[model samples]
Target: MKIIKFGGSSLTDAISYHRVKDILLREKEDKVLVLSAMQGITKKLQKAIRTALKDEDEVECIIKEITKKHQIVATQAIRDTEILSDILERIEKKMKRLERLLYGINYTEEVTAKSRDMILSFGERLSVHIMEGIFRAEGIKSRAMEADEIGIITDGEFGNATADLKHTRKNLKKTIGQELDRGVIPVVTGFFGQSKDGYTTLFGFGGSDYTAGIIAYSLDSNVVEVWKDVDGFMSADPKLVSQAHFIDRLSYAEAAELAYFGAKILHPRIVQPLEPKGIPIVIKNAYNPDRTGTVIEKEGYQREDVIKSVAYTRDIGVIKIEGVGVGCKPGVLSFMASTVSEHGINIKSVITAQTSINFIVDMEDLEECYKLLRKKHSSAVEEVVKMEDEALIGIVGEGMSVTRGLAARVFSAIAEEHVNVDMISYGASKVAFYLIVKGKYIERAVKAIHKEFFKV
Candidate 1:
């Protein structure tokens, strides 16, 4: 069995949907297809939710546009007139439900975490509905299923939740397994799942990939194919370095480190479930399926290159805490960690000295992170500093773990460019080395390292 996932761009319109159908039909193995929402739908829903929180009626216009967009895709893609009509009816019903939710939020003038997740989930829900209709119209027996319906239960962390692996695995085998056995292709929604209490919970940004991971693990599928618009994972962002090349293979750890450090091709969480099982993940181009995309598995490809890719993220901020007693205090670091966790702010990386500490976190969480630290840890922190407009550049490869002088080579390349390093950390797995620099230097740093390591 195979579990396949298509990104938003792969199903943006009628043409894309038809292409996905063709790809699935050609697959010889029994497969489960997972889909993200059409491009721009999730953003529109998020905007509608924000407008409702402001006690405005703007959600109607957003919902109308969303419904119309889906109708256009469904009508154009599904050839059978009767099937098209049925799909439109179902689409309308879903829209009405969304409208009611929006109206309730506007009337209450509040947007709780659970409500927000439910609002965002419509993207995947609506997309799969259209796709399933298209599949059925083409005489491919298929059923649309939501992630929650497949036994994907999570904890109550509304915005980003963790799956109860043992329970989820057992239930999915029963639910999805039954459908596959009956010769039906199950088209499942990608992102949000229900909590144990049945509240909709997200897996945070790029949650759709997480959805694919959980399903792949539960079924013990042969491979998880992630269909995207790109050719495959590259040695660097092509836009940054025109010389950047595609990498054909990577170990699970290398892929995860690159994703966490800012590779856009796959979400970091995708490897969470599949890694332990040693299942291979193929990142392929839906548009160019004949090309061999990147493959990530347990055993990495043996290559002469020690550095596989240079990844970078600009959405980063640094928090610096320092005092004579800062590092000496037993719980100083632990207190800072607890405070950030309490606020749901994730610290991406950290750098420490005898008298000071620097933390890297998502730029979106900067204000909350700074505020919480100041509010709670004022006594231990003599000085607090926030650095904005910085980027973390990472070089990832399993070969680096056994190779020496890799760090010196990385530092030399950056130094040659005169870019200042703000903070740095090597992954405990030795698969990656990430260093912070001014945001303006990202393109330069990435190109410099890619050219130095890969081209050599």
Candidate 2:
């Protein structure tokens, strides 16, 4: 069995819908398909929800656009969209409820997390309907399954919610195969998940990827195809370096390293559950489905290059808490480390000196970390201590440790490029290495590394 997921851009319009049809025809085998909202719909829905809270008049305007976009796509994809009247009727009812919610928000003048979720949930809800409509009209047996129907449930944390995978897996296993056995392609709504309380919630960044991974894991499929705009994971950020190369294959650890340092290729959290199954994920281009974009699986797999990808994260800061005389003291080091973790701040990397320890964190949480350290270990530091906000550049690859001078090669390139390095970290694992540099130098740094490696 296979689970295919198409990103927003791949399902945005009639043309993209046809591309999907072609891809599906090629599969011609038992499969489950998942879909994200049409391109721009999610953002537009959120904006409308926000606008509705401030003024009741905008909901109609927003709903009109939503209806038209889907209608156009449906009309073009389906031979006889006359049957769309019933579908449109159902959608209209949902829109009417949305407009009424506008007045509700207007009177309250307060948009809570739950309210925002309830609004964004419309994106997937509507997309799945249009997709299933087009598929059915085209004589393809298909059915739409909303998040709640498949037990894609989460806590009522509102804006960002984590899925209860154990429950979701059981529910999906029972339902997905039955639909396939009945000759219906089960199209799942991506992103929103029902809460334990039945409220809607999201998984924040990379919500769509999370949805696909969850669906794939549940089915234990051979491959979870993530169809996207680009080819796959690139050697560098294309926006920064024009000559970046696409990595054909990478290990789960490689993808995680790149994602953590801001590769923008895959969600970092996608690895935890899916990779354990050894279910190789193929990232393919929706526009050019024939081309093999990239494959992510276990280590020691064959690959084209020693380096999988070079990625960077901007707007990062490093924080350091120095224990001048407590370096060898086991309990003291534990105290300082526990202090930062207790504040719910992630430690990107920790470098310990004879008397000091420096760690990296997201820039947004720098202040909280600063205050947390000051409160818990203020007396430990004898000299000045602080956090530094900087851009982080990472060179990720499998078997990088084998390339003796890989680290020096990167540092030397940065040096020749006149980019000042702020801090660096790497472990014995040697698959990846990260460096901190000024945000302004990102473009030049990425270009320099790309040219040195890819000659682009």
TM-score of each: 0.97, 0.84
Question: Model 2 scores what on Cα lDDT?
Answer: 0.77
Q: All predictions: root-mean-square deviation over Cα?
A: 1.4, 3.9
Off by over 4 Å in 2: 155-157, 301-305, 315-389, 401-404, 428-430, 454-456
- The C-alpha lDDT values of all candidates are 0.87, 0.77
TM-score of model number 1: 0.97
Winner by TM-score: 1
User: Lowest lDDT 10-mer window, candidate 2?
Assistant: 299-308
Query: Candidate 1 on 146-182: residue-level lDDT in tens?
Result: 9887789998798889888888999999999999999
lDDT winner among the candidates? Answer: 1
